[model samples]
Target: MIKSLSVDETDTNNIEADVIVLGRSLPGVVVAHRLRQKFGDTMDIKLLDLSGVVDNYSSRNVTFQVPLGEDDRQRESLDAADVYIGNVAHRYIMHYMTEFNIPIPETLFRTEVSDPPQKMYQYRDGRVVTSPNDYHEFSFLNFFQRLELNNYQSSLDRRMSELFRGRREDDADSRTLRYYDRTSMESDLVSFLLLSESRDVMRLVVRTVCGASAHSVSLLFYLHQCYRNGGSRNYVGGANTSLREKLLGYCRKRLTRKLQQSVEDITFLVKPIKTIRTYSDEQVIVETTKGDYNYVCNQLAMAVRPEELSKISFEERLLSNLWEAVESARGLRPRQTKKFQVKYAEKFWRQRGFSGEILSVRGPILWAIEKPVYSTTGSLEKYSTLVGFLEADDEDEANSREAVLAQLVELFGAQAASPTEYRETEVEGFVPRCEDYVALRSLARTSSALVVWGALDLFADGDLAAALEAGHSAYVRLVLSMRPQAQDFDDLSAMQWRRVLPDTSFVTWFNTLSYNDGFRYVMYCGALYLGYRVFRKYIIRS
Candidate 1:
């Protein structure tokens, strides 16, 4: 059973713990659990949550009624559309789940039965075009168009592989990495679209997955996210389904199957932290809003969102010292996403021989996928759950439930008009859009007792796997600090969290041809030749 500390429970003047972790996110939980596993009962470790919930990620989960056997209606199903287990988070999540005896859910791509038809339909100019296994097989696309699409996809993957895994110790490659980081995805897309593009496929793909327009997203950040956690092969095309489809199939109302054990051994406190005052690398005082007690801990790990830091008060020295991190956190812009699900009694799309996957440029619905539901006995049920996302920040009309249903009706016929249950959730969170991740890294503060960990702080990626990795790294650092003699762990300690502002000056950008090293070199040679010619002409005239 889940347990938490009440307001009256923490009425003591002082509460002491060896370590205190703030934020109930996966990263914070991992840090607390790892520390407990390492030190056992020897150390007093405490994990705190403001929301009074262990897994804050699953807080948005919706539970609804599903009819059970003969006059009993207790049987129910979970709908967890937002939580997606990516390839990066798979290994770490599996390890913890197995240790805690958590049951894994079925995969969206490979099921007990044969694979479903693999296709994503795009509603183009008055017609629906299929996203096929091979672009060559797409009859609507001409040979040149097909060739361009294939080239673009392969080139993107290849570039991402190099930027992420290539030897960055080299100067040329390092500069190249920085170049991409300073560039926007929209600029890259514009260059590609200039070559007689038939449709805005790249824009659609980026918008559907990122939940933001290409112009706002950093090129390097976008590619890094796609490249991380097993890259594009796990989600897009061929054998695997797209990210949108995976989210739809993964709609679970409860995470019990995923999290049977809630790390019950550790002491759990339910209070919103008001301030963190750091004196040295080894000692800090944490104050909560509800309790008169002050938490004195040897170490404090921050696993919350970057923006959340503004809510808590820190010592003046720590704030002045970590100014770059504070600014980067404040610089992060909000990315709004609205997810909706409609449930029906029948699998209408399957009956019509449809894949239930759609990508549309039309109003309201940006993307949609059909998910299959199973009964408690592990048998496929005769129900349809259509889950999709809409652009919440830009589309004002698409904000309503009625607008969504009308769009669905237009796409899936009269049956879409009535859904047994319709639910929608709108989320406004800070994403790594235009933020300088290089600066965010400065918040690592590994040497200090106040270790900060945000989604974009270290790996510059926001996937669950990255968060788990961060938690593990923080644990190792904390351990090494306490035990200086131990050196078996990987040397991830060299990563600097200092933020470096990109050179956006007009002269600097002009000289580098907007960060194009190759083009700049060409211009350099041209200028030298022209200069020599002018000198020769002056000498002859004299």
Candidate 2:
């Protein structure tokens, strides 16, 4: 007989759920949603978040751009690979939905693509392999000129697309198709090159996408398996909401209904969780802020970083290897990121016949997204705003903003850069620093518990997507291990864990000196993919 678990009386038992999600971030939300989709009303789920309110910035602030290089061949390769991966990922998620008898809107399957621009670059092999949309075909052929290279690229794309494509014919409205057209070429080029060089490249690419460092992660961590297997068309308003606002809205609609009314403190005992106590082969007692809570599961899936996990209390002495791995995991010092939104009374840039997306490549204000958001009242009377982000490292916040504004004015002239209202958001935590990042990865292995032993595998080095994927994978593995079926022990475990390994082959080839341009392109793609994956996974889980 299946028995239900209960929390302390002080914790409101008013809400009953099968899962108690601890955090309300993106991962939490994603997991919650997925579970709901899988079990519907049968699964009682609740969420407990720190702030009691979901921050929408996580979703609305995102800028989705299919990075295109100046080379045609490189662009084709990247575009093709992106499409292949996206479709495969989407398909895998859809399979889960079908297996679990979930009901979702049919519209979720509809994906859309924007028109291809005239001038574009495909960067590969550290050079501009092709330029202009007109030369895309020629560049693809030229870059893959070698008989073996061409065959490999073609085969990889075909196999990936075949495995994931739900729709028989490629349709214009498919976002997956559009992404493929834009990024597959570069991805294939990078994949092929990495497979040829050190296997570490593929591992790096995969880990980078998942949000881990190459040195500690396995080479098979694929983000495609962690994605929601489908796409949606952008609303007519043009995805105008801020990232934070979008995520918060989703939380309000789905998560708020499942939370307990009290706040619980989180504290560590004995520095780290060493031995987890099991009683009568039924319940596992864990130390928490309120006291010891009994959990009936054989494994615990934590969504926190390895460094954070080290702070939890364990009942028994953990294996030396797991302890060392956890101890070795690096802590990330928060970095400061600032965003400035300048609103103007009129369309000054448009009046000057300029497209709002302009780049002052050499200036502190690198680029600007014109008219990023729309007024809530549905009137165009509101002023158009220019949103600019500045990368400030160890600099005074006020000074950095001033310098960026001043530089913008110099590039666009006083009239164009002038704004009637200015708003800025300063983000302090996990600043993106390349040097410090490399150092952290080198130290992240500090645990020996099979679960904690893979602490290094859990170190994302700031790749949010990989972190989210790892969390989900961990959760799934934990759950399956507790209730193992006859057929569940085969290749499933390998496939699941392999998804956490960094694809070293891909990383080495993409980072090769000859493919510097492709390397940068791949990095950007990996970062964005990680962010999206993390947000989706965490939000639902929470």
Q: Top TM-score: which candidate number?
A: 1
For residues 10-75, write the lDDT of model 1, one tens digit per residue: 556767788877765556666777777767888788776555655423433222222223112222
The weakest ten consecutive residues by lDDT in model 1 span 70-79
Judged by whole-model lDDT over C-alpha atoms, candidate 2 comes out at: 0.35
Error of 2 at 335 (Å): 2.4
Provide the lDDT at 312 for model 2.
Answer: 57
Q: Which stretches of candidate 1 lie over 4 Å from their true place?
A: 1-12, 52-58, 61-87, 109-120, 131-140, 166-175, 195-199, 232-261, 264-274, 288-291, 316-321, 374-382, 394-399, 441-463, 484-542
Segments of candidate 2 deviating more than 4 angstroms: 1-21, 36-282, 290-299, 305-310, 315-320, 328-330, 360-363, 373-383, 428-475, 483-542
Location of the lowest summed lDDT over 10 successive residues in candidate 2: 231-240
lDDT of 2 by residue, 443-529 (tens): 222212223221123322222333334334433443344333422442243223211222355643433333334567789999999
Cα misplacement distance, residue 175 of candidate 1 (Å): 4.3
